[model samples]
Target: MDVVATAGHVDHGKSTLVRALTGMEPDRWAEERRRGLTIDLGFAWTTLDGGRTVAMVDVPGHERFVGNMLAGVGSVPAALVVVAADDGWSAQTAEHVAVLDALGVRHALLAVTKADVADPGPVLADAVARLAATSMGRVRGLPVAAPTGRGVPELAAALEELLAGLPAPDRSAPVRIWLDRAFTIRGAGTVVTGTLAAGSVAVGDRLVLGGREVTVRGMHALGEPVERAGATARVALALRGVAVEQVARGDALLTPGAFRATSELDVVLTSGDAGTLPAEPVLHVGSATVATRLRPLDAGAARLRLAAPLPLRVGDRVLLRDPGTRTVLGADVRDVDPPELRRRGSARLRGAELAGRAPGGAAAGAELARRRVVRAADFTAMGWPVPADATAVGPWLLAAGLVDELAARVPQVVTRYRQLRPLEPGPPAEVVRRALELPDVDLVPAVVRPPLALREGRVVAAEAALPPAVQRAVDGVRARLAEAPFAAPDANELAAAGLGPRELAAAVRDGQLLRIADGVHLAPGVEREARARLAALPQPFTLSQARQAWGTSRRVAVPLAEWLDARGVTERLPDTTRRLR
Candidate 1:
């Protein structure tokens, strides 16, 4: 089915236009007819001359009902922009256009209704010119007098021609249906209705909501039972394990994990507030909204602070609305920030990057959004219907490529720094910490030792080898130790040689040599022998026994014993008893 939405201000004849085109009243609820304004989404369909069905979505026009309007248009891949010829454009006309653009509605036809009231030529021309400027630029205009019979058939023909050019909706992808209505039939338990969106729902198939998978008890279409339903099809489903109290309007039905959650991301605001640049707008991706605070002080690049968790991806176009003012601001989706919240003003988004991701493909935008972590607030703010229980969120996945690059670069940084500053192995663990930024806590451990590679007070590894002065100092220390048995040249003694405490620490850290303890250094063979003898002992013994066992003095024995005790190799009792664990 080719779905199209009707948009205009309240009482501006949107329903009349739909009714004229479809020969069916779109106002399903009695309240809707009484008020003459659609409070909720109303669905209707009509056959074109060649028997092609055009699913018509009658969207609300009141600013108060913007949420309903979005829900109505969100399901429609195409649209019929209905503008009362006498009223021209209202606040809702621009808002509706923005909403449609944000939802990625690219194909549409403009229906100028109430043509009999005034000369519609000017209004039609304006709508056509504006349509030519938007993503839905190819929008054709038809002057229609919905109350009379003016141009209704011609408009239908034009709509059919417009839809015919559109490729069939892809229902073969992941199942995602944005629910517009939810209720309980005493016998049915829970009944939910929405456009089938994508993919077919079969008998007993799992319906994932809020991370909980429910079974499909039955399905219905056009007031009749059906075996399965697909994209662009209005469907009502009786789902197992779902309750009327638990389900609400604006909730979505999707396959499990079809979207993931995120905390922070990079986005470019395309529609601005009051002549402001469209670099960043408070974004709504899928079933969530985000308060996007621009990074680096609103310098075109921005970071989104989510109100809730949501599933999102790169190129996922989201609806941005000014929360306080309640007007459409603009649309944008995931970019820059992948899994990590970037430093404010650190990076900017490029249109080419987003375009490359979207490429005018069906799933490209959503696929890009999927790879990213978008919070629930973003979707909600964008007028998406998020499931109430859907809260599994956060900690977006970092691309393996970026991770791998960092992993490879860390050691190199350590080596280079060490070589450049020969007198030092590296800055304090904190000093080296500036080299790379990490996304989350889990990544720290996998990169190196627990948390990160740390030494002294700094968190950097030497990227370069020890400098000449430090290298010579290290060689001198080794030379002095080799020349004399148990000769340990202190850092002060090697001060003229240029190696400092940190340089010696780095060499020891790199495992090129061993430090038995403070003021002590030893060869690997000697250390191994000392370890073997200590391992054999079940208790701490006198200095004489240790001397006879390993042939070392209090110089090696005391420090070695302390190291073992620190490692829990042996314990010291109150009575001076030492026993190995």
Candidate 2:
């Protein structure tokens, strides 16, 4: 679906033109109709000649309601510019056109309304000439006597042509619905409506609103119920688990974790009257209005400090208008997540680098991926869908070169650690993650491929050799155990044989020692022989019976029996007697 909003001066027949086009009353409020002026956003739509539907968002044209007007047109790709033939172009016309230019709205249809009441040709030519000066230059115009039957069909046909040429919405992208209205229905609980800028939403898909999780109870697209709705469609979503008070205009409903909201931005001034913007302006983008502070960085570059968190992307067109005076200064978002300017001349240095970066496309995306391991959400937030050529590790998008580097470094790091402190297990994932400077610690094991493996939660090379000291200690412990196969050494005895806790653990990891319990250690082959003797004993033997059968002392028998029971090799009876598995 294509959504087109109306823009023009107050009482210029914007709502009248919409009513004539759609045959539906756009002014929802009773006060608006009584006063003959639009006070807030209004909605109406009509089916084109060939079954194509155009959703018309009718915005108030009064200068006082310009903020509300901005909220209406912020996301709509096209605008229906209504100028009354009698009134000609007015001050509000210039302001609205400036706003449209600041927002980069390039497509428009000019309707010289109330043609029957005045000479429409001069006003039509004037409106066209004025539009040519704004960002919405090259607009198609027609004189429409909306109250009468003049030129409505031609205007509708022109709208159809405009809708046909609109770029298809990216339905596969993550959903970001910048809410413009939030209210509770009599029976449907809480609902919010907005233009779905990207991706799709289904009946049960999870979405986040201001960091609070909400579930979709129902959905309506262009006033009709739907189980799913795609991008570029005006949608009303009935949400559960969030109250109407909690959700307001400017808060967004988004695919959870796929978007990040931030208050700071670094932007390149794509076009504006002032090289340096006013200190505090009303920053408008994607249905959001924020009180913001601007700092000029360099030529065509500046920084913004916003009052609220906004989910933004690199290269996004944002309008900077002084809130008190309402003068527009256009900007293109260079970086949505900006670094702090801690020292003098930092903004200029960063601006120089951003100015050199590509605005959008494959080259720019690849450069972004190359700098660090970023989440898939970061890519979405930057206004780029995840590239097909990019490599993903779970939620993280790793540069192929970074993955290769980490893969190559993992074995080398583990091998080095093992050579130095072989008595210990492999390096913890955090250590390797930090060493590699990876963004996510979870990527540690992801790089440890085939010849590498994770052991006891630490990444280790498959054939890592033990340290010489640990190897020597292991050998001495083996010799001592071999001298008396049934006699498991005590801690002191194991220490005397150069096997402290560290060495003992290393020997166990290397398959030379079997730890029955704390202070109880056995050679690898001893457990099998001990279990065989237990098998030869009478059924349901007592601890003393097991001890006599194994010919070992109470110290060794207790842990062995317990270990056997824990391993399911033996079961203890109701009366505490032992039974083999």
Candidate 3:
């Protein structure tokens, strides 16, 4: 199926042409039929000679309704540009053609209506010449009088040929349905209609709108209920979760999580100079019209800050219009997620950086290079394929040089951490992640290099050694314990020997000392010696017997007996006597 939007002057017979082709009323409103003018978008469809289905979106052509016209044509792939023979070319006709050109609509056909009232040859030639100057280059034209049906067959044949030459739509592309109509049906909750330009939609599909997920309760194509519909087809979706007042024309039904809504973007002007644009303009894309502030970056590139967020991506074509003058310019989106211009001359530098790049996946490498590190999901949301050379560290995609640079800094970071706190082994993963400015702590392990290893959830030096002062204090304590294995030093005695809590903890971590309890420090092998001595006593001895056997005072004996019990070296009986395990 091919959906084509009609464009031309107000009274040039755009609706008339569609009505004649489809044998159906293009105008739905009574006011439109009575006034003999198209006030809003009208829809009709027909089967061409070769059994090809064609849907027509009849758009209003009055200068006042240009917004409506843009909404109708934004998502369609082809157009039927109507020109009246009696009125050769008109103001709305020129504006409509300009809009199509700005939107990069390349496939179109010209219909010279009112052929019976005047000679069609002159108007057809003139209209064809004007269209050739724009993006719709040299469209095929014919004369047709809708009322009398003169040359109608030839026009339909021309349309069929034009539709035949269009590029095939990508059914696998992410779905973005730019709604043209939103209202409530008698039984259905809310219904929205749009031309599905790419991808496919099926009943029961979940679509996103305004950050909320809505289910497709029902669907129709060409007014017939269908379970599924693909690209280039006109579709109406019955939505389950939203009210009619909540949705309106120009809203979009999107594939969930497939897009990132952005308020600021950088674009390359495909048509007009950026310096001549208005400071504030309206941007139209995919049936969405948003007020924007344009900041000229260069002669051909600029930045746009939108009043409302839109789900935008690189390579998306958009039309910027100065509402005051009704002049439009075409732009190709270059960056959806742009860097902030915090410093002076940053905008100019940004423009220079973007000058040489194209849009879409072709520019992915340049994007990754500029960002250095980005979440892989962000790239997917922005509609850019991840670069092949990017290194995946957990959920992050790192530039080729970034991994090496981060790895190179790890050893220095750990060394500095150790220098600041001599007793500590290494920094925790979160501390190292923050020091490296990495997005995820899990990525720290990926960038860890030789001489630095991840151990016990902390980045550790391969040969962890205490400082000279700490090692000297530990040696003094070890010598004291060697002389009297059961006589653990008191807190004041250990403090006088320059061993604080941190120094003691560091010694324990290095296996130089064992902590029997708070304020009780012993040598590493002293616990085994105490347990051996206790075993020599009669089985199930009292605490006093164990204390005498070890020759330690009550201060050391209680903690030692408890530590032994906790270590499964001994168990206490109901009578307060202990025995070895």
Maximum-lDDT candidate: 3
User: Where in model 1 is the C-alpha error above 4 Å?
Assistant: 273-299, 324-327, 335-581
Candidate with better TM-score, 1 vs 3: 3
Query: lDDT (0-100) at residue 548 of candidate 1?
Result: 54
lDDT of 3 by residue, 1-581 (tens): 89999999988988888989999898999999998889999999999998899999999999988999999998999999999999989989999999999989999999999999999999999999999999999989999999998888888888899999999999999999999899888887799999999999999999998788999999999989999999989999999989889897888899988889999999988888887679998999988999999999864889999999999988899999999888889898988989889998888888887777886455797788888888888887897888888898778999868889989999888989988977888999999999988878888998898788888887887777888887888888788789889888899988998888888998887768888899888998886898789879999899999989988899999999999999889998999999998
Q: By lDDT, highest first, what's the ranking? A: 3, 2, 1
* TM-scores vs. true structure, each candidate: 0.60, 0.85, 0.88
lDDT of 2 by residue, 169-225 (tens): 788877888899999998789999999877889999889998889999999987799
Question: Which candidate achieves the best TM-score against the true structure?
Answer: 3
* Model 1 lDDT per residue over 1-581, tens place: 66778888885798988888888999889999998888877888877887787778788898887767766775567888888889988888888887777576788989888899988999999888887777787678989998897999999999988888887766666677767778888888888888876688887889676567788898987667988877768888999987777876556777765555555655555555323523344555433344554442232334565655555555455666665666564445544244442565224333334333432333332432444323444443332334322322253333324445555666666666656765455544333335655434344334443233654444454343455666666776777656543445555675666655676676676555578787666654554455567667556665455555665567766776677678776676676555656
How many steric overlaps are in each model, in order? 60, 0, 0
lDDT of each: 0.65, 0.82, 0.90
Q: Can you give the lDDT of residue 345 in candidate 2?
A: 87
